[model samples]
Target chain A: MSTIFQDLVDTLRKSTLHFADTKKLMNTLNIIVTIKQVPDTAEVRIDPKTNSLMREGVPSIINPEDRNALEAALALREAHDGTVTALSMGPPQARDALEEALCMGADLAVLLSDRAFAGADTLITAFTLSRAIMKIAKYDLILCGRQAIDGDTAQVGPQIAGFLDLPQVTYAEGLELKKGGSLIVQRGLEDSNQWVQVKLPALITVTGRINHPRYPNLYNVADSCDDAKIKIWTAKDLQLPQAMLGLGASPTTVKKIFEPDRKMKGEMIPGDERQMAEALITKLKEMHVI
Target chain B: MIQLVPEKCIGCKLCVKACLFGGIAVDGKVPRLTDSCTGCGACVDVCRVEAIIASGEKTGPVCDFAAYKGIWVFAEQHAGKLHSVTLELLGKARELADARSAEVTAVLLGSGIAALDGELFRHGADRVLLTDAPFLANYRTAPYERIVARLICEHKPEVILIGATTTGRDLAPRLANRLRTGLTADCTGLEIGPEGGLLQTRPAFGGNIMATIATPNHRPQMATVRPGVMQARLFENKKGETVRIAVSEEPGDGLVQILKTLAREKSSVSLEKAEVIVSGGRGMGEPKNFKLLENLAGLLSGEVGASRAAVDLGWMPHDHQVGQTGKTVKPRIYIACGISGAVQHLAGMQSSDIIIAINRDPAAPIFQAATFGMVGDALKIIPELISQLNANT
Candidate 1:
């Protein structure tokens, strides 16, 4: 055969194989991603007089690490045929986060919002989310961000695993679905990396290093704004005991919030850039810091 | 439920300002609770006229606080070495235990690691609870959870402290849920309250603010403290008794399997161990600019650290990040180059003995924490400083 003809035949054969692989039912997975809408921490400030958080102008964004988790779930679904459900427990405004997840290609979005869930700590939040997860019971995997920026507790995902009686892996940066019903995950530990394998129906919490989240599709952005694709659930919708739903059910309570003392004021070097550098070096030597 | 007593309402609107959640509106002559009301009691505490009444909706079986006693530290170990945080926690436990006239018990788990009990005692443990088993050698969530939960049920510890390392973060929450108790994470301070409750103080909102939390109605009040946040002391010549608990055979292979572990390189010390750290952030502009930071760090015989923004921007690895989500460091010196010093970053390195901040923005928050502040471009300043130091040598 001619060289051009031979190349054409090979390309055609590769496309045929790709089509066959997609048609075959293998390694399908159902994934649920748990996300949170957190106020942009950089913009968070405290009201000096009231000594409370000044959240007036702070914009709420999808928790950064949770975006990585959603990206991991979307990538998994692309490789294997499955559905990705994005779930969150917060105020009604949390629907904005789920809608963004929908724009990112999540098959379904759920918002568990109610006044009763307002003062929930990590444990109550986990209980509320786990109740929703049980309601959407057809899943082989659950993914969550390692922690939310606002609370920084990092307890909800593991607590959800506890509530659902599922095995869990935390701080996952890499994931691979095996041919069988197991997943190999690389967990980012402090000062080390650990690879572990767990069967299906397990939960994994992902760190920000896992993958960069893709921008939401513009078309999906418009469609995602439609209220039909997003489902809202209150404390009553989950049918969980009110005792395990909110402030009263929480094991931990916040006694007070205050600003840490900032008493130290440094001496600012007064000079041009080059002059400041020279002065800094001299001071360092004087203090023996260098 | 948050209710306003209209008869006594002065309508000072102090409650409105105190409601962090924007739950109260003073639109009416008296404040009315909105759907946003979380009943956090912030408004109730501020209402000097006693106009607001906050009543929490009670639920669940009440805990019998009297039944629980003694303080427990989950003494974590890797390979054959005990984590330094374990000692720090034991020290804090010793302080709390001393206040209550209670004993401090260190729960040590690992195969053939009973030898660690001596160090635990020297660090302030009154007793050591050892569980040595082949299955317990590695920290798989299920087995460790089962063993630790079983021990807690049997011993009835009043307070439990775990290091907020990866392993502790994984294990503490599961145990909390299984026990149906409350747990606080990454606490900076732990103290016994006037009402005999464990007051756990931790940073929230990305370390922009601090909140004091309490497990008021739960037994075995648990909190995870990050390393270097607490001081570790030695009791020199102190001794404690060790009770070895037998482990039953696990029913089957665990749901998860450990494939491999890549231990950190010994030559590259962790940021927490570095005496000096020259750090960079978003203001470094690009990935290549981090080289200047590396050069400065090399000259100072120190390591290079990155703010979360630099790490997230792929300018540096996650291991180099210093912030609320990263390793807490208290180095002898911390040089923040072109870093704006987010509160999260300050939470990690502000405790350093000396801080030097170099940023173009005079308003950068890092300056507030710096012992020395230079308002200039880091790119221009670092090279000049490097040449100057080189000439000095």
Candidate 2:
């Protein structure tokens, strides 16, 4: 990991000359990036024993797109001489993700964890996160991953922006701070790319296409593990009301959770490779999909 | 918190079977809630003895249920053309409306796009709430959210359906929060519950599981369904009344300004639009081996796609990746070559009209999602396929 980080740093050092000298700017951005720790869903499996998701050994990692969001925040800070706060809401185990963020050059890391925060849906989660952001109090921009793989809702960022009543730009593939306190963001839409300019104090959710997240530096990784560098906050820290904190506050309840019904299974084609190829072609032709 | 009423406990262990998370276990005579319990209420419904309950679960209507009426679809339009998802949503809204005996309304927002209302009407909208303004011509978060939130505040539609497209995903959440209502995202299925609530069902955990959700206590229940998940039926000559919502010509707040919109380059195949997709994965061996997939895609007039493994290995571009971290594609025919289908990869393409898997291992999970499977070396079989195609065409 350190070798990759070193190589990327060397390449980035060479490319840094091409950018404008942002140090001349009158004011710099204070950015907050929201991240989540999720089970690497790629390797997640259903356990035959309990018929439940086999998460016993599934590795937890900073959500893929959240890394991109952190990279965006880090890049901005590097260019403009600002601070990047990596904030997260999850169980205590989520500190690993925040540590990774700090190792990747986040100036500060805050983990919001408490038993009262369990079982919150997207709305309540966003509400709780918004309250935490309020406690952080000074932020020119808020960045988040488009969605977490566990949920796949892509709702939290915009919902947070909603609770804060801030303008938001989602699916951001690229962003740059401009003169006059405006942010120029390039959004990757379904069929097109849109360029929008929003003022500071807005929220942006970045996609993985935005940038390659840098690996944590070897030295930074060691330092990031120091407990003093990480702050743990609970529901009381954010002054959240009991009625607004947990499962009870969440309006949407999960009525059921089950393995996806496999309505149709593929028929295995028989015979040798040549015959199999020929058979597939015949079926495609018959379906008029050739 | 999940609770068990000891007096009512029968300990049938049905709740244990119902819980997908293994949150409940029958200990001796009574079932006990474990720390893993998410309070999802799956156990509560399965308990025949009514012993389990998620205390503080909203059982009564939190808001006046009689005040809210009508089913509304946000008729998303871009450059004066209605997005097909809007029509699909209208079809869904029509079904939902019929279930509850409510009127279907399409909320159209654009400048000089009243002509699109006719299409909404033909697609099962009983009414069109037209909000035409210069500022509303293109989608910007602030103005659109403001207007839509205002309309919802005034009209109080019992349910609002929006396509989970780029704009809708961005708009709906903020609007839902502003209205202090629950909004389910990327719902693949929606139905009126016995209590007249919208039961929204969507895939979760990288599509390993399906979760049904409901906002039991919120008014104007909201949900966003992804495009292509719902079918749009045309009801030709269906008539509807248009109610004009006058908006100020001036831009509100001026927080965001649209600079430009660029259509994606035509050189790259649009994976979502492609009818056929030939995908490669880790088993393809090397980056150079992708040429086989490229050739196959060219012959089939399809696009080439890749699994996350191939992309992570630097064998393919990120845009070509199909998985939870990549694009979700539902082509008519998806050919998976040398791919061991992980749940994440399956989440993206399991909805394809037909899936053909080619792998050397018959036991590979990809076979489960395939419409037809062949256990063989993809590198050898692909060449055979190419040669055979040459002979035929």
CA shift of A209, model 1, Å: 2.5
Chain A TM-score values, per prediction = 0.82, 0.85
CAPRI classification of candidate 1: acceptable
Candidates 1 onward: DockQ, in order: 0.35, 0.34
lDDT of 1 by residue, A1-290 (tens): 12233244335434533211122323468899998999888778656466567889687888989999999999999888888889998888777778778778787889999988889988888878887887887889999999988888889999888767678999999999998889999998876889999998899999888998987754455435555567898877865446546887788889998776555578998898779888888887888877
lDDT of 1 by residue, B1-393 (tens): 666888788877866754544678886557788986655554654455557765555323235668799999999999979999999999999999998889999999898898999999999999999999887888888878888887987778999999999999999998887666789999988999998889999888888877899887778799999998888999999999999999875753378999999986753647888998999999999999999988988899999999988998889987799988877999988999989877778888988998999999887778889999998899998998888888888
Model 2 lDDT tens row, B248-356: 7444447888899999875475787898899999999999999999898898889999998899889998889887557778889899999988766787888899999
lDDT of 1 at A88: 91
Candidate 2 chain A has its poorest 10 consecutive residues by lDDT at A17-26
Model 1: DockQ vs. true structure: 0.35
